[model samples]
Target: MSIPATESDTATRALEVLRRLTARDDATFHEGQLEAISALVDEHRRALVVQRTGWGKSAVYFIATSLLRAQGAGPTLLVSPLIALMRDQVAAAERAGVRAVAINSANAHEWDDVRARLAADDVDVLLVSPERLTNPRFREEQLPELRQRTGLLVVDEAHCISDWGHDFRPDYRRLADLVDSMPEGVPVLATTATANARVVTDVAEQLGGDVLTLRGSLARTSLRLGCLTLPTSRERLGWLLDHLTDLPGSGIIYTLTVSAAEDTARLLAEAGHAVSAYTGRTDPDERVRLEEALKTNELKALVATSALGMGFDKPDLGFVVHLGAPSSPVAYYQQVGRAGRATESADVLLLPGHEDADIWHYFATASMPSPSKAAAVLGALGTEPLSTTALETRVDIRRTPLELLLKVLDVDGSVRRVQGGWVATGQPWEYDEERYERIAAAREAEQEAMLAYERGGTCRMELLQRQLDDPTAEPCGRCDVCAGPWYPTEARADSVAAATGALDRVGVPVEPRAQWPQGADRLGVDVRGKIPPGERPETGRVVARLTDLGWGGPLRELFAPGVPDGPVSDELLTASARSLRDWPWAERPVGVVVMPSVSRPQLVTSLAEGIARLGRLPLLGRLDLADGAPDQTSGGNSAYRLAGVWGRFAVGPELAASVAETTGPLLLVDDLVDSRWTLTVAARELRLAGADAVLPFALAAVG
Candidate 1:
């Protein structure tokens, strides 16, 4: 393909300009970074660069704007989230002898000059925040001139637009609409350091342009991840002193609260280390001074809140230590990502006290609403838009419940914000028609992760890697399981044996596939006449039977080839009746025996009846079925059954103990295979307590 004029000459000129600019001692671009800049400028379509901090991301924009201006492409607009970062970039541009300016939240009249320059095609680039673009005056006045001559709309921190992003801002959603409304086919150049696959997709879709992803490997091989379980703040500070004392390079110590930051700094200084503190409460001028001081290695270590990391590109930061647990893994990752920017090995220490877990638990539980409250919020907002403040005032609920209700409403599309207020745009009664179904699905996935973290008896790193969809993961030999036994070795061995034994005892026998009728010719009356009685006819039964046999269950023992000679005992009959009733077979009748070749409806009805009976209050306590797949054992299966029993009898650990005494093989069916609760309870009681084989019923029978 022949290269476009904008692609060839513009990129070549941009590289030349960058080389000239970086020749001055004040400006510097790292090796090979100029090529990255060239590719970004050369691309006729929109592009993205996922470069680490201190890799000259700002230099790419500065050089590209100069090239675009020289190519007569009009002006460029840089939309960033932080105002301080905008000012820093404009100053940096001036130092490089480039005529550049910014119109941010602090300077309203500066935009008029920017607009005039754009009309005359005078300015190279104008940096503004997303919030400023929402202003009616700017949109109506300045945006028109810039749109007609705009070269590129650069979206810094592009991850904010994604729902799965760590910092999701509602205002970022309006960016796509703004870009589409722009004239002259204004292509976008988005940049971020930590976007995963989903974040990359969101940025591409939102920008409405072809994507050029420059994602480097996420493996920070140099940084060693470590966790410290401390009991008190005194001990934590002592540990910090031991690590940071006489450290040659600068480092960051992060705290959650402003007071904690100040206190930690004070303690470190008293310990004879040159230290400083930065928080939101710090004066802007002082904060800037502290950042500069750290960059120059004047301060040995900086004890600060999370505010210090964003937009502060310090490549040589030797270590980043968190005084307490962060709100989420994203926050932790971002903080840790600050160190080891130059591919130099760094250290990250996480000191999580007991209170840290409690704080996290509070946040998680407080963020979700009860089912009834969610329904109530939807009902109150019926077909109307209301602001969040208005809903809080109108809805009779507490803070936690109110936040959860809004989240549910937002997910269900029963409510949405138009402008600054919420609107009820969804069918309140239709659960399946939710617009935020994707959001809900993401939350459910996170919930599964949290549940696993709290209950799974495995390495923590393995769980995190699996949740984040990271492939090619090893055992992470540093976690609790890899370093030391999470459970006693003997206990684990016994538990595995018991779990295997339970399955062995409960599995039933089934007839061989070769002995059964096959193909259309096998469906005749005589062929049907040869079929066995008391087995439900279901489409999925064959699959379930196969699974049971593989798990060493009683599939063969329960369905031996020979017919019974006498009437079956009530105990055996009850077991069969319960199995037929509770199992999710494709077709079966309730309380009615079915020959293997019975009509589908008859089989369906029986199975349905059995399911219904087992689901009823009294009998429901006796059995628990997993959701989705009937053959698997899940935590929810046991939890739901235990919950049912608890609801009926107010039973707790005592009842659980009594149930453990049963010698007969217990057959449990779960809907899903990866339920942590089912695994926890079953492993604890059956394997640890020496129960008979615990068979997992694979088929979902009705009746």
Candidate 2:
């Protein structure tokens, strides 16, 4: 006798229970959330939930899973990146009388149990990391069995898949492939607290599904953001002690290095503030203990690296103080997100200093063995693939250095390897050219966004909203800038007066121009007279003239007597090649000629100094100069000055345009033109706009 459809109708009953839960006062649902849920139910397709931080995103998945389980549809599978989050969710599920289990490295035999339960259809939900999910044996043998009983695939911290995202994880790219191999068209529900429009698109694309975006307000009215420029580390500690000593509840202090974290924790503890340090180096048990202590408010503050915030949730955190600048806004946002989880007043303090930024830049631009190392490793492996350890021995580099090199190469698509081995995939590096270009644009956009936030005379919330693609978002009245109603009026009057006075002193009308002779002259061009001594006569435009006349090679050859005729020492050649190749120049010849003039050690330092100074001048609002010849002319160390200006400009535009294209709408503000970044953004935007290129402009001199 066949069972009747109604007899096995768990799904229908689950839907009813969901409706009832929504009706209860304690389970309030926003209209956007309701609509999002409705869409998911109606489409019967996988949906990605892209919501801002603190928007009750977790509830959507929890309720969805509960409803599905009640209907006997199948268990929900949550692929989380953080183990701590998995434990928390499991505990919460148990408290709610829902059956849940987690499978990770800690419980080595847990996978066997999980697989058995999945086969028997006895489990409600299973939580595991992407790494665990992608295990070859698990995928080949157990996954197929599990997939048949899996209803939903929830990817937490979904932004990690986006190349433009701050925390891009290689493993996440394979998640879409895993989901695709599932038996049923299991709906994927990805959730994240942060991600602008571009990030949203990236998540959808990565998951191979449509997005059900429920972007709640980013405005945290109860939270305050402030930057304190401390001159020394001691001062930063003193400031933290003064503020945190009497504060109630818990707090987190973010440091740049593991050593710094340990040191800071020690300092705080010695000063009688209960503090503990957490870093990647911490054992799993210690980390869990610290997290539990933080949750219980037993620890007043936890000094940590970026590792501490991923999966841990403490609703009562009252403060998030950054001991140093995070590498990017994404990181800064994540750290600050730990605070203000509840509807209470909180504060995020950024102890401003250049040390952290410098350190990050050092790592970002540090020298590494060329792509040849990857090639050599692949060659050594022959037709066979080697494990990471085996490959390290063959390459003769330390595991850490080798891993970093391989990761960079992998990201650059300069090499490919099997998941378990160092053997070349035989396929040429399938570079995601478009994706790489998009990331470059996004970085430029982010740089611009950063500068805009630092310099804009507007409400911080407004700037943030605009950066995040909420163009019409209203000013949040709670920010320092918005709180002072009288300041804007005074600021506007002062700005107008300054503008009027400058215009009078200059005695030149402000107007956009295709080419301004006077502006060109100030830039070292012989606009209205014969070429100056030591200048190219043909172009009569200084650096441009040099490039146009092909005099750069002759000039460089004249300056450096020991310059080699053929291949030099490997190190020297590599240095020379990188200098010639990597310098940010509008024209390649200019970079090639000028790179040798400044020593490699001094280049970045001088550039940083110049950028800092240039950032302050109003008239020089974003200059995009071509990298000039290194040899100085009568116009004052052309390469040094131009490099300084260009470097500053380069950071904003290059980073902004690259990032914006991948991550979406960004507001860039800088003192110099970021030509490289701008060129890329402009190219994409121009294509979208039915154009080829945006005409370059000198914001100050031309206007």
Candidate 3:
């Protein structure tokens, strides 16, 4: 039984914690920081802080946690969005004399210890990702107790809670349910630097009706913004190479795609820049290393995708250059906000590419949950739990989208993931048709705004601030529009040539699938487990991926929807022959076999014929489609895709005879490889027909 902390006591303690956190006795609250902490600790209310970056949003939560714990309350529970942010917050919490610990994917081994400490009441703050809330074991075992015992709940990057936000996530929506279930007197706080009026209102309503919202101007005075319209990928790369060092201090070079990031990083490295690519595909351990390298100024800059967004803190970061524009102004502002946080001045440049709209469309469609697909998933499920692979065999949705749909369904209480897998909850779930349509329309408008930002005539900073509905948006007298372009308008001729040559280089490895997708037997496909090496296709080569920076542009044009099917172009044929010439194969191919392509038959045939002619190999007959076989549509999990094409192709008498005559390996060519199942089935057919080996070649591979 302890006494409640008074207002004066809370204020003194909060100030002490703030000073400790920042390691400066002279440091004071940044306008609303102290008020936010007092509202949580003293008033015990839900609050949302919408301030610009570097305004000490973390200080509010850290100091409030201190005061709450001092009042004999339970430890604060923080739901952070990213691992990098959690790491930084934990370190900051420790500096304030708060015992902080995080349980994320990177530290599963220490969870037991964390739980033990929680039981002993030794931890003052426990941070976890929003995904953790849906985990069956944690939801059942830890969350119930934690909710009742939590002193305060903090949702960092709270914009993710609203679908209208630029970076909405399904898991973040769980906060409403968590808040509803928490015991009375457990204060809640949500913080974000980038949120428009609509997102702010939506988040406030979700948190509760009686929530205190603190809004501020989104302008960054220390940043000088500018946009450059580059017509080609080569020119953008050349500009970066020519001016990367001259920009300012070490910073980030943001790319819209993983391949672009890797490509840019490679070219920069060749030019003696200490940079590395950071993307979703990067390993967890390596991500940590890269984050530290950037923080410590060990690397000049990181070539990154949006995966590097949110929770990365480098106060002295001198510049941020976007190789491609993001789809929305909110996202662009959030990313560029990373620069000039703790510096006097920093350069923020945008090199808008011609291909930006195409990439934008891909991401825009991918994130939206389809109603038909969700219904198909729900209809396929029963009372009993089923694994993702088993569900995939019954549904037509692709793996990534299916997984996202499941998360959405789970958040809506329509499904629940249990010990073994996921099960239907029998809860009614309605597709909010009007709301989804509105959100889609809003996204399109945002895209238009981004385009407007590129065609700049207004103050860049003012445009970004207004995009976030900042009431204080005004000209900063720093952007290119206000001061004229501060960056070079052109690249050196030699740099452009180097970039052009780099993009012109082709050849991407198309690795053969090893094990078959699980649960294929349920779909009437008998294959499972590892593919026999004797029947496997040798490692293959593709002219390029549809997502590559160089040749990808032409490949994307060739595969664009509504484009009429035709024979391969002469330039592509020459490039394909060059790929064959550069191949480091173990043994020369004796012949070339074309895979049946219903969509692009002429293109596939021409490509195979051209390769055979160039290599001086015999042109084997094309494999025939089995009777009653249908053309398989793209998009689905491995198992579903495999089942669709399992027995679709067969080696006809002519191709079989040709295979038998060829004692050495044969080359199998296709136009595009998406799931890689057609190539697998075709290679197996050729191998069964007594061909010594099969080598797969494709014009383009889907990313």
Candidate 4:
């Protein structure tokens, strides 16, 4: 049995823990922090702390951990959200004289050693990502013993646990189960700088039993928030070029998309700013280096997507500027909270884009799974293991939503993963239509609220606080609404031109699919492993990615659902011609052929004909699709995609004769290239027909 600490004993020990953590004699808790710490240390009660950034929430946990361990309790277990957060927490814990270890994707090689340390009681805190909780090996081999010894379980960025939260994560929902399983009277804490009243209530209920909820004024005194709506991407990039250096200390420039982040960073660098881009595509090792660079002020700014959003700690960050609006005010608050953490006066500016809603819609739909798709996935899975790509071939679901559904199913006990791939446990799974509907409705409301935030006349900071249900919400007198406009609306003409040029620049590499996807032979093509170099198309070129900052806008408009397919526009034709001329190749194509487009035939035909006419090459005749052939490029797994388009395309008699006659490489043009299976199968047909080589080209490609 554990004895409670006296108030005086808890106070003195808390001060000691703070001093060890900050190495400052004057360190002390702000407002309710001490009470939260005391509740854990003295009363052994669960608590949830909702406070603003820079309010020292991490201090509460570190101090509480130190005191708990001093009383002979076991190590703290932290379920953090990102690699960056884990790194910071481990370092913070060590600095405070608490030995710490983290087991995540980046440090897999150290897992055995770390597990030994934990079992031997050599570690004081262990930080793991939320995803690790669902791993079969970890769950069966390590978790049970780990849980028995865990002194206090901490869930950082607690809002993620709530389905209503702006950044809802399916894995975080597993915490509710963990909380219920913990030994009675062992304390737990959930901390987040974000979270509205609803999110707080939701997370608190998930925490189980009676939880002491301490909510604080969600105000960051250092932030001077404001919004500036831009009419175009060019103006937004130009503004950054003109005004980036004027901002105070090192900070982050947040963008709604990965391409925008990269484009902004590149333009800023060309104009002599020290900046780097951080996105989901960045390598894990590189992300660590970039975070350190920002913390050390080595880079003036890191242009980033929300990959850097939750649990990133950089006190004294000077500013945070958004290139476009996030879909929710709650998310916006969490991001802007990264700034003005330890200093007085940090500028927070939102440059909302006209195209933001379309991006929002695209991302939102990618997560919410349709019922039919979910059923197909379940029907396809059995005791046999199948990879994500395999499931795609069988189910109509795309990669993103399929993976999200898998996670949802795994947490719900409907499916379990094995070493080979994923296997269904033969458990019944319900669609949870009512819950999904509520979640969908909540998302739409958040989007509208975010839009209102940009259009609202009230104090920007106060508006945000009110959205989070902060009763103490009041005008901070620091934003544009409270004070006069502090930023310029106009950018220099030359800078605007530069920005436009950057956005206008087109052409991205289309690397050939080197190896045939696993299990493709069963699709009836008989091709396996590496394609013979002679049969494969050379590395190709696309006018641009549909997701590119330069071409994404026009391409999105062209491909948006229900848009009638038509001939390529004059400007796009000119751009396509330029792409052909700019493409660097070992040898120029001697002729051209068009791939049949089930969805955009006119666009494909007109563009191919126009190009062949200009280049003075024969339009060798089109690859004809057999009637009823499935549209391969739409979406599907590799094998089925191959199966759909495999025997679907054949060289027409004239095209076969022309290919046999051509002694040189031929170019294949299409409206778009997504999976590349359409091109691959078509090229294979041409190769068998005696074309010397095939060089594939598309107006746009999906990354």
Candidate 5:
């Protein structure tokens, strides 16, 4: 099998591959699929295809790889973002008799074999994640040769390359360098289903010269769209409980956060529904199992987060129900597009909530790098590479944000990650204020558009299409606004009661910090390595986390900024008491001690006194803030946080005398816990002043 040697011959070969891939004897290319394939196999040109989901984007690449391989071109190199996408693509390629292999975090054990296959020309297509592009061994040794001889380069979910898009990834931004390094006559293809006109233009500019762009209508006639405004999370859960079984078939229930997904899945399962939760925290092996279960109709729904978003293939996912509105219409469109790809019609519904805006604000700000923080990170690095743990001691950013900042710096050429860790590249870097501002403004506009969709004045499907700048936007006549809701909106009274009960049940373990953060001694703190067993606090309990589905609402209200300081509410007090009663501690505390609070003095005092009175324990005096100690806000890396509170709390004469008299562990109470550093510092002070053991209790834990 050599090169076809003619365009007609190439098309004939590609059609055969497509039929094999689809397992259909009469299969043919969709509207623009063959043209894109021809551009790659015949003309060897760059192509961008922005079609709806399930429009055979993968087929274009798989067929092109087959033709190119027959023509004696080098194996196709594919850059994918998610593991699930790679897994599914590998399976699909095998059906066409194209040998495909992948190298990613989840399959590290097979990397050697995969590399051997590539070396022996046993692989027709080689897939690697965008993050792997920067890996030391692969980037330095293999990628250079592969770039020179590559037959075709494909970028799946190409919208991620542009920062203007909703889900911009720093790793994807590095693809421009890879594109520039490709040899002459090597074809390139970029495909995505969620890019709007703005994103399309940005991606095109990055893909470089004379790319063929093929975009089709974004409308999905098989989707029946609708919106139900449910003000509370409990009500939304009740609605699902009442109507989940009534929906067409096995489908997805999307959530805005991991805790919401877990909580929803638990409540539904308790009601005798076969369901499970899927999120970023879920184990990779278990994710594969759950995805299979849904495909086989073994489970009713998998309440999942955006981690399950892109490249998951199920032809007949009967419905998609959002537990809460996503931050933007573009993102919402991408998620709901997962349904109705093969079915005649699939249900799509949005249950909008008031707390959605707050969650949106948190996520939007968390990803963007701060100028001051970036500078701090850069200043901490030098000729020697420092691991993230060591670097955390010198910078004020938290671990997650610190890692994100480093990736952005890497993309900007200000730093480089090597074998040991990261080092400064000494390259000049400037924060793009104007670009970030424009992106922020665009996001605000998208959020407003999403709100308008929820308000329901126009055809639901048309509104989503217009948001994507689809030229074929029009009424689908399948939405609630086009043709009244095809499903019910009411939840039975008993269902609501069940949901309320689930939400009200509370108590989460607050695991004690075992080891001190690395390089803490550099911050003028003497601690390093693990804390001594005697000085460490016991595993404690919180009434709930601020992110919990049930008690989160009240906890958020109580800690919201600008709220007037006040005594503990009776409702929270009762819940706290209940939590304490149910805690399975090895030893009960003989007394209670309070940590001084500047922000909520009245609330902290009241909570401590009430707990002491209820439990018949003495209320020991509170620890005092050292003279001129600055107030600590809940943010920053562990070492920086520890530095702020080092020697900040002092057990005064009265508290010291009371501690000396007590015989058992003392209960340490605080209004809220973020990093748990404050509680650690206060507990250390109490232990040294002569308490036997300390147990931490908090009103709420920050997610």
Candidate 6:
């Protein structure tokens, strides 16, 4: 079979590239993969690829890059979202004979070397985070040159470009700026596996006019989907204890929070299962090891937050079990799609929690910056770059929300981040109230759909496909809904008890603040350097983190907004007892002093009284709120939190006189520990008074 003369060289080169990439004598494109490669390499046309997970989407870009580089084009620019995904992609690309390098937060030290490689034309592809675009140093120093020479612009997880996407990034929306500045005939490719019709349309529009959109059926026949509506966290944990080993191979156990992932992994490990916790806060090196452990089947599962989502490549993953539902159906489908990629069958189960809706609300509301907050952030920035900590002093917003709002402002051209910190660009900015409201509506709708998926009326797979707007969606006849439940419904009492025992084990190290936040002096706090070891409080105890499995559910309910603040619940008191029993404190307290929780006075006082009664200690008195000072708000960045409470509390003469007679350490109790600044400030007052030590205790700790 000789090639015809009319054929282009790109197609022949694509074939050769595919063979080398796969290391197979006989390797062929999967469905539309070849067409996408040809469009970028041969026709120099932009393309959008929407396919199911494990459909070889990465192959298209890798093959196209190989062909283009050989044709004398410059390196491809790939912007990915997740660090874990980026590491996996770099490894995969290297295995395929492509030289890929990345500049991300995880590998800051190697960026200079990577940049050097890029300049030498020795790198076939260069990857970065979308957040890198808003960086003024990168934007002014590197991006212009790279943009001029980039052969192809690849947005991997392209659905993130649209706010309508389940996992949208404010930074991803900045791709429109990159697209607008691209050189003529420099082809672009956007790829995603979990986009609905709306997201597809939004992404295609960003890729510019005359873009070719290639979408395939979003169906994975190898996946046997099921949903178990477990009534309680205990039941869900019990089911996992009983059935995890029965799953065919290693996979993932998805959790909604980092604490959940950590707790789940700890429980599984205690039960003699080889499991690892993968969360956003996990050290980069540890995350890599965990990912490798899963890939090599050395571990049964990686208990994970959505931090593990987007680009992990595990072809033979046997199952994916969700302890709580994600906020949307498309997001759920994308996660479950990780399994059954190369195998005959894989189990996919969703165990929805009663708190799933509340968790969803927390995340959803967190990402959206109120118009006033956004304006305040912009106003806070100046020509002189301000670090995030400095900006926190100028704006009342908390860390997570402030970071998100800054990114949104950067995308809107109202701010720029330089070497030192972020600066205002002085560009006119609009609130776009209508747009924000529209996205909020979409989120609510998606949330409702997710809840419906849990309720389970139609084929589970069919419902997910429809949520993705798959035209070919139909009854798969392989899901619990269509074929009836294929998983166990009952969990033994012993298993449940074991899980409960793990959850009930409560005590967290209250690491003392080693150094005061820089710039605190401007806020009227004169403290700096390590608090003299003598002034620091003893290690404290909290009932549990609000995200823990055992006590997290009830504590969240108790603290739910609009619920009246009252006395300590018996469970909390018992949990506190566990903390007291386990305390490695040098000596028990002789008296109890209450920190005035203006927002929760009754709860705080009751918790202190309960501890005093349990210890047979005297209830000294409460720290008085400064005259005319408002009760402090709960949420803010560390700097603002400290500023808000710095001068707001005073140890009145009555409390000082009462504490003088007390012996040994004094128990300092509060309803919640958020910033720990409150505890630190209160302890400083107590230590100044005559108390030998101040041991802080709280009902819950919030991260």
Per-candidate Cα RMSD to the true structure, in Å, reads 21.0, 20.4, 2.5, 2.5, 2.3, 2.2
Which candidate leads in TM-score? 3
Q: Would you list the C-alpha lDDT of every candidate in the order shown? A: 0.53, 0.54, 0.90, 0.86, 0.90, 0.87
Query: Which stretches of model 1 miss by more than 4 angstroms?
Result: 1-12, 20-43, 95-97, 106-122, 221-225, 269-273, 327-329, 342-345, 361-703
Estimate, for each residue in 499-563, the C-alpha lDDT of model 3 and write its tens digit.
99989888888899998888889888898899999889999999999989999999999999999
What TM-score, computed on C-alpha atoms, does each candidate reach?
0.54, 0.63, 0.98, 0.96, 0.97, 0.96
Candidate 4 residue-wise lDDT, 1-703, digit = tens: 1223344788878877878888888776678888898899889898999999778788888888989998999999889998888888888888888888999999999999998898788988899999999887888888898889889999999999998888788899999999888988789999998889899999999998889999889988888888888778888888889998889999999998887888888889988999999999999889988998999999999999999977477887999999889988889999999998779889999999878888888777777766777778889999998888777667756567788999888878878877767999899888888988898888899899898889858888898899899999999888898996888878888888999998988777777777886766655667778877777787787888876777878987887779998888988888888888888888889999998887889999999998898888999999988757655756576766777777888888999888888888999998788888878888888888898888898889875
- State the local distance difference test value for candidate 1: 0.53
lDDT of 6 by residue, 1-703 (tens): 2232237676677777778888886877677887898889879998999999989898899989988888899999999988778888898788678899998888889988988998889999999999888777789999999999999999999999998988889999989889889999999999999999999999999889799998999999999999998788888998999999998899999999999899889988989999999998988888788888999999999999988877677999999999999999988998998899889999999999988888898888888868888788888888998998888778777778888888888888898778888999889789888988999999999999998888888888889889999999999999999999999998999999998788778887677676787667777778776788777798898888888887877888888889997888877887887888898999988888998875778888888888888878899999888755633577766666777777677888989998787778988998888888888888888888878899998888885
Among all windows of ten consecutive residues in candidate 4, which has the lowest summed lDDT?
1-10
lDDT of 5 by residue, 593-646 (tens): 998998889999999999999999999989999965634767788888888888
Q: Candidate 1, residue 664: CA error in Å?
A: 76
Give lDDT for model 6. Answer: 0.87
Global CA lDDT of candidate 2, please? 0.54
TM-score of 2: 0.63
Q: Please give, for residues 6-55, the per-residue lDDT of candidate 1 as tens digits.
A: 65665456556656666653343454345555555555556777654556
